[model samples]
Target chain A: MHPLAPVTAVGRSTLSMLAAIGRVTIFLGATLTHLVRPPFYPREFLSALLSIGWFSLPVVGLTTLFTGGALALQIYAGGARFNAEAVVPQIVAIGMVRELGPVLTGLMVAGRVAASIAAEVGTMKVTEQIDALVTLSTNPMKYLTVPRVLAATLALPLLAAVGNVIGILGGYLVGTTRLDFNAAVYLTNTVDFLEAADVVSGLVKAAVFGFIVALMGCYHGMNSGRGAQGVGRATTNAVVSSSILILASNYLLTEVFFSA
Target chain B: MIAMQDVHKAFGPKKVLRGVTLDVARGESLVIIGGSGTGKSVTIKCILGLVTPDTGLITLDGQDVRRAERDAFLARFGMLFQGGALFDSLSVWQNVAFRLLRGALKRPRAEAREIAIEKLRRVGLTPDVADLFPAELSGGMQKRVGLARAIAAEPEIIFFDEPTTGLDPIMAGVINDLIREIVVEMGATAITITHDMSSVRAIADKVAMLHDGVIQWTGPVARMDTSGDPFVEQFIHGRAEGPIEAVR
Candidate 1:
């Protein structure tokens, strides 16, 4: 194959992907803009809070605990070679507060919350309930999308904070029992390593990830195609896109906060 | 009143509505008859702006519907979907009062619930059913709840897309009677799309047959027997042979 031929094909494919992304970005922005305007539905918002927030706590909490305990064991094993095992508690605290806590919680919630929202809304769209809402003079964006987005945005940060505490506690348990670290020393090291800025930054990341997850779910659902296959594809796309964006965004945010 | 002139809609290679045109005067019930996939529902969807026509003008009460504010234009019409499309999350009364509970029509919750219960009664449903969710109700009850919701706002126009599609004859007749009674009582213009001859006879003042992306024939329901169009004859009588070809 000619080098020019391959270059042209690559460019075309990249352009098409960019165009698709642009369309979704514009759709999400318009939906968010509609969210802050009038024609608000309080009942729908309450239902979403019950569905997305309250129902999501147990799963998110469990994910955080296991991840924290695993992180503590890994850090202790790695530091043992250099006799830097004393650093386990400090590193685990900083790690949970700054990175694993928010990002892991976000990924887990996105898998559960985002996929379900997308599937439910997509099925409703395919079945013409969205059209029925429009005919009933209810804006679909306001009635369906806004409440989910709002609930996720407000609820995820709180969930992230809870996950962070649970994860650190898990790390403490592992450190005290398995590694033979003094409980008092472990607690002091953890306290000394974690700063308010780190926790605040993680919460901020959680909020942003929440917005992305909900936005992706609603966008894919609204633009889903005609049948069951269409709904399945939308749900898959919502989860994949949300997870990828969360990880990519975590890196960018970490760089912004720590590098500068 | 609703009118469509030279409407056209296509999905890629297949043209669904090709220059389809018709009109429904105020208080008239027009039943559009057609074989499956012949665009009866598409025509109603076009008028409702759920599926925008590629070209043509749709007007309601002399106002250009396609160019008007969508929510306000839609506010004048009520639609009973093929499956009833009731919101599963809401109680029966809330579903009925969905419109009145929000936006400009927002009412006190108690007042809205009372109005919902009254509408349910109008549709032959009891007050006790008002607290049940859509999923908890039977198919006929769901249809009645959908009808109650449709008429709750007292819209000027109503569209019924296969309103009796999945019902047994008895239940279908009950829904047909309810629709006719509501239309006449409200004096609302009604457009119903169905292949059910019983429904056509019960609800329509005028009947139009859709075939091959166009209106094959249209006239008062009394003249349906002598429509003189082979497609209409074949469809109305449920015959396998005529000008209409049945796929093997």
Candidate 2:
């Protein structure tokens, strides 16, 4: 191999990564700019809210329920070593409200809403529908990205709030029925343990996660290459990128909210 | 009038349009013909500012297309895409009335629907098809719907990107004739990109052949049969062995 071959490969990959980052940054700026501008499509925003928020509740609920139950069982088992199994209710409540609730809801949405948005918009791009929108005196950023992004940003917090409630209830159920704890005491312990900061931070994380999911979907979609394969690739990229960003941001936000 | 001067475009290392130049007069139908992947679409897209050229100047009515206020400029033009490109989620009437339902040109919903129905009828589609989604319609019906949408706002310029592509021969002829009638009636400046010889005969006032990122020959449609340019002759006759090499 040539002596410079390694250097060339590394340089090329680095440039490609930088280009991708540049494209995404520019797209973020464009989306934010369009979000504040006039000519908003309320109908599109409402439809996106329905699809991204309302339709996603069942999956989010089920995921959190199972997670909360399993978390309660694990916490009880771990606490039993110290004769502290009574901490299950408080631990489960804190876990559900502070971390798992928002993070899991985000991942679920990254799977559902992100992939759907990418597929829909990528297909539209492939078929020249986006160009058609431009020809029709419509700015695609305003018509498509802004609405989806705004809807997701506004919807995920509500979804997380609902999921948090349902998750805490799941833990209560498990703590009482499965672990032989008193139901009323489990409820009181959970209520006493979770502060407003915990719940509010979770909701804040949900909002940011929502924005990431929608933004990744739109960015991948608007830049989709050219055919069925391109659209498929865009959908996969949307899910993968959004999920990674969600997990990474979860850590950072946790640091900001809870690190002491 | 629209003009493109030495427009150059490339996607990475593959050059699409290289020093391409062309012009279209007001109330004239200029049909660009070429082998697949010869930058015909890129040329039109450059004019529309959908695809920016790497280097060039494009002017419509003596003003640079990119410098014009976007909405006002786009509102003066219409486009019929190759695959119809109808918004699948919208009903046919909504697709047709897309421009009229929003932006600076917005009209009342009832009025937009009425205009959409009228345009649909003009494109030979019945009013009953107005409520059907693009996905529910046949390919031919979809193209008609796209054409209806293109003409709905009565723009001063119309672009037809392979308007008859994917249609049966009869439907292709019908669409060509419809396009011809519309262009003549509207007296709009028009640009069409297609390889179909029949589309050329039916719709072109002037025909330009694009090849290898350049306009090989352009002239009145009547002179096309005897244009004497090898590229034009080979393309019009659908010859495989010629200056134009088949990609495969």
Candidate 3:
């Protein structure tokens, strides 16, 4: 072994990490540029919208609903010690709309959409289909990345909004039935405390999470390693990276939106 | 009409192509043969701008390929990938007519499908296979579909990367003949990359041997057997020894 081998290896790894970041940044830039350009593929966009938006509704709905119900029960039980049991409706609404709704829905999509996109594009990479697209005079970024990122960006906000509503409904059902709270009072509390800013912030976070998910998926897929192992690794990385990014960005967005 | 001058490329510490220089005149079929991993695929990819050279000049009709308008530059070429590379989601006709249905070459949907069907027939596939997906076809049929897709737009140039790979010898012969027939019929500049000597004999007007990243020898196909270059002789005769390290 060389005398400076250890130092050189560390330096090399750090440089490669930085280089990876730069490539992903450039990939994102290209995707955004292609998003606004002409020669759009409406059919591809529609297909992506259906897959990322419509098909994901059931999972998002069920996840948020159960979360909201459990949150209401937990808040009720915890609030009882302080004689603050009636706070269930307000807390659940705020929790679901301000943070949990978008965050959980994002994680769910990160699992579903990101993995699928990565696998599809990664397999395309290994099979030379992406190269085929280039040979056919179609920009792969335009054909593959733009529609997905655009659809996810536009769709997540809608999904989060729906999830927010469903979550509140779940809280209402649990609070009124499991607890002794009056139905009208719970509804009024939920309705009164939620400002437009809270809802808008959640939707904004959802959009950002959407962008991260699709970008990570496409970036990994387009640059997948070589074979079956490479595609599998790409899919895993897409999900893991998107999930981490979603969580990290969620905290940052929360600080921006709600910090005193 | 395509020329690559002293092209060099390396993927990290491993050098793939080192100073590869060759030219394919208009309406010529140039087949490049070499051992596996000798950068045969990379050479063609460099010309098509799929893989940028680390240092080199690639020109088409004397215009630098890198500086050319991407869409217009690529529109003049078609490629048949080694594995066919047909879209899994697309029906056979859709795969064939992909270029016609999109971008600068957009056509009416009905007209595009008609052309796709016509090309499919030219490649020896029946109209009944039009609606099938790529996964439904045999390897030979997939190659035919790939060939049809390659020629669907009547491109001015075509690249075939291992067209005879993964097929029975009989099927390989059929594809070789079809490729030769199509090149002549379209009057297109052509380049084929493969290690199969049979494919070389059937498809090449001229042959270039790539070894250790550079063109070791190039001449008319007729002169290939008597060229007397050790590398070409070893490769053409499929000898395991002489110069090239089989393990490398």
Q: Could you say which candidate leads in TM-score?
A: 2
In model 1, the Cα lDDT at residue B60 comes to 88
lDDT of each: 0.90, 0.94, 0.95
Better of 1 and 3 by DockQ: 3
By lDDT rank, best first, the candidates go 3, 2, 1
- Indicate whether candidate 1 or candidate 2 has the larger DockQ: 2
Model 1: residues with Cα > 4 Å off, grouped in runs: A1-16
> Lowest-lDDT window of 10 residues in candidate 2 chain B?
B239-248
RMSD of each: 2.0, 1.2, 1.9
The digit string of per-residue lDDT tens for model 1 on A1-260 reads: 78699889999999999998999878888876998798777878888888877888899889889888999999989998999888998898889888988898899989998899899899888878898898888889888899989888878898899999999998999999988989999999899878899989999999988888888899888878879999999999999999999999999999999995
Give the TM-score comparing model 1 with the true structure, all chains together: 0.96
Per-residue alpha-carbon lDDT of candidate 3 for residues A139-238, written as tens digits (9 for 90 to 100): 8999999999999999999999999999999998999999978999999999999899999999999999999999999999998999999999999999
Clashes of 2: 0
Query: Which whole-number lDDT from 0 to 100 does residue B52 have in model 3?
Result: 89
Best-fitting candidate, scored by lDDT = 3
Residue A147 in model 2: lDDT: 95
Q: Candidate 2 deviates by what RMSD?
A: 1.2
Candidate 2, residues A82-164, lDDT tens digits: the string is 99999998888889888999999999999999999999999999999999999999999999999999999999999999998
